[model samples]
Target: MTQDPPRLSVTSQDVANHAGVSRSTVSSILNGKDARFPQETRDRVYAAATELGYRPSHAGRALAMGKSDIALLLMPNATFGPQLQEGIDSLAGVAATHGLTLMVRFADPDADETLRAILNLRPAVVVDLGVLDQAGRELVQAAGVRLVPQVINNESNEVDLLIGRMQVAEALSNGRRRLVYASLADWRLDPVGPIRLRGAEAEAASRGVDVTHIHVPLKAAGATEALAQVTAGSAERLAVCCYNDDVAIAILAAARQLRLAVPDEISVIGVDHTAIGQLVFPRLTSIAVDFAALMEALLRELDTNGYGPPARPDLRSSVRLVAGDTT
Candidate 1:
């Protein structure tokens, strides 16, 4: 090695030279503003940079720009947990590729407190996965900051209800009505439950079939009572569409208590398509929604500016008619 040509002091200028473009053009492309240039031209600059291993130090760029280049991710909970952690992981990967910092904040459900915490971060973009209520939306907007809401459940009117509603609709279509909806107390008013119920009602109305919809509070005693009604002899069919797999598993346990034969006498369905759904007896006929893809699209939307028209995802997951003994 002839000292590797003095290490070549690789810079944006070198990239411009290799790509036959101006230094300014290389700057724009490396700063994540390649939209200003044609795709071909952008590709050439990127390729030249890769060939040279030209890495622009993000910390140096932030210092020169008087900006932190950080992204703030906000969620509903008071702390980062598993679901929020997953979002952080995915978002962090995207941020690193773009040379940005990621800061996560959990909303305390108190508007003032949450708003203050978010504003302090001064993020280039804010992503909200936990904002659901009207007040929550208004609070974020009032912050005078760019915010992206990822309310998959009924937190906001914007996000899709693929998981909950689809599960309910599919369960009914499979002739598994006499449906019991079980939910933990916190999820009772969740938009998912009502939306799914609406879908079920619409389907039931169209078919002119009478289906019993029971709302059972999620608890051991309450599940016991609901199980009795579900397994009652008057009902020819029995199925439970739980708010989530946990509730469904609990109902399954309750069904066992009542000596009810699953799928033969009752079928159980659940939302979330969680691992518990698979581990349960007879497997479970569950609505499989792409939570990961949903999160990806959501972060992408948040990172971009000006609330461009919402784009629908090409990948759609349907609830599998998982033919377990329970239907």
Candidate 2:
């Protein structure tokens, strides 16, 4: 009796044959580089692959494509926590689909070692997370490495502010009149923290409301003392607009230590929409930013601005208000 063809793994070659195309064409379409193929041909390849149960193995595909697909990210003093790692993982997954690999490297904030390292690797794409200075940019140009500065400019600067404003809007929509702004006392986020605060303040002013701004450390110990006046004095509607969920949750912990009630006495809202926020006694209301889309936009820009030190690299993030018991 005839038996099934000797058990073997499926490859792009099988898909190519089924689609009446070369393996290279199948590779290009599967890798998301579909500009070369017409709409009908692209559809045919996708259908044939699905019918043949073809799955592309990422191993060694970068070299097979004859392209320099390595991407390096140098960010000094990065937290690399779950939230940040989620963003990094999204980037790695997207890059892998495009036959590229993304590597995140930690560098010293006080020295030029990061730039020196960048020069050594000569990656096809470099994402600088506010650590690279002017000299770093110049050296990257000299080394022929694509330098992408992750700075906010006219094109995408409002996104940072949008996060804060959304937090305030959520509070206001919940019938809360009094709002407070809580920012991290970190230098690394200089203009970013101030920018978001300013946006919240501006929106509050427009609505004829007053916002109390407070800067506190990352820890939860001293937060109670710093915010005791607001927590103790007000029986009125109150909410804290924290820089991120970390700070917001810290505020919650601090309030607990002071015997202050949440939602009843105060409501807390933060950005980042971290997963930890969900586990708290009262789920946190947060401004969720689409980090995957943000990275996708920046990476696509590399094709256009790949030659010189990267442009401001229009960084955009889609913000959404996630409702929870906190608000």
Candidate 3:
């Protein structure tokens, strides 16, 4: 297949010509620091830029700003849920406000090449999702790059603790006796999944609740048989604390196949208020994470924490129960 010719990138001069202004005027308005231009002129320049789909080159901006114009986000390869994607969107917005652009690169933290690339770029800020040790921290600080580690993963277990506490409390409040955790078996979600499982198990153990660990596959078919067996012939009211909304959806299908009434016979609570969860039959009740708040926390950590020490930023995502027909 013939590839399309590279679309000519619209430049600042092009925008200036379209807006009937000097290139320097376009540049000044784009900088947002110069207030010499009138508000109307600025608006006109912005409108022209939007119409042209003009984006400033990061290297150009970095040269002008005397620093990398990028907030580099690691672990771009991971499957980002809607909430994390929203958080990243908020991060990008914040970065843009600071005259920095957001860039994503796929490389595991353990790889030496990733560190080398990070040091080479020396981005304005590095928001990390994977492991970073003391050496990595020192390298980043030595290179004058600010690093924030493990924002989404509950390395400190605070967010997990809250999610676990909420799941246990909500199920117990509704008089659920047997609590089964839909533990994820995917290798992609290792530490986070285990951390969440621990949180739920800890809460259940404290309340004299028995939480059966069911290692469920990522797909819909992997869960049906296991769920059928678990909910087969138990006298107690069961509530399955799902790993996430996808697992919860699998449980829903499994419940349907087994001919069980939703909330009446078997209740289900999911984490992550995914879009599909809202539209499903007996709409999914989920512990919706506060992505906006988490984004704030990430920014705060970047500013305040800096790179003095290599530690997981102590952050917790605020959560709320979005009630639905499921539980």
Q: Which candidate number would show the highest TM-score if scored against the true structure?
A: 3
- Extract clashing residue pairs from model 3: none
| Candidate No. with top lDDT | 3
Counted clashes in each candidate structure: 1, 0, 0
Superposed model 2: Cα runs more than 4 Å off? 1-69, 97-99, 149-152, 185-191, 218-220, 232-236, 305-317
197-229 in candidate 3: lDDT tens per residue? 888888998888788889777665677788867
> TM-score, each model?
0.65, 0.69, 0.74
Please report the TM-score between candidate 3 and the true structure: 0.74
Candidates arranged by TM-score, highest first: 3, 2, 1
lDDT per residue (tens digit) for residues 1-327 in model 1: 432332336766788899999876776578664665898998999899888888765455445544345667766552111343455566665654444556666666466776666555545567766543566566655655556643343334222344444545655666645655554545312534555555555555665644466655557677778678656666576766666666677777787888777876777777555666787787876655545555566656554455564555443442233444456
Regarding TM-score, does 2 or 3 come out ahead?
3
The parts of candidate 1 lying over 4 Å away from their true place are 1-68, 78-88, 130-144, 149-160, 173-176, 187-191, 209-219, 229-233, 302-304, 315-323
Backbone clash tally (model 3): 0
- Whichever of 2 and 3 has more lDDT, that candidate is 3
In terms of lDDT, the poorest run of 10 residues in model 1 is: 151-160
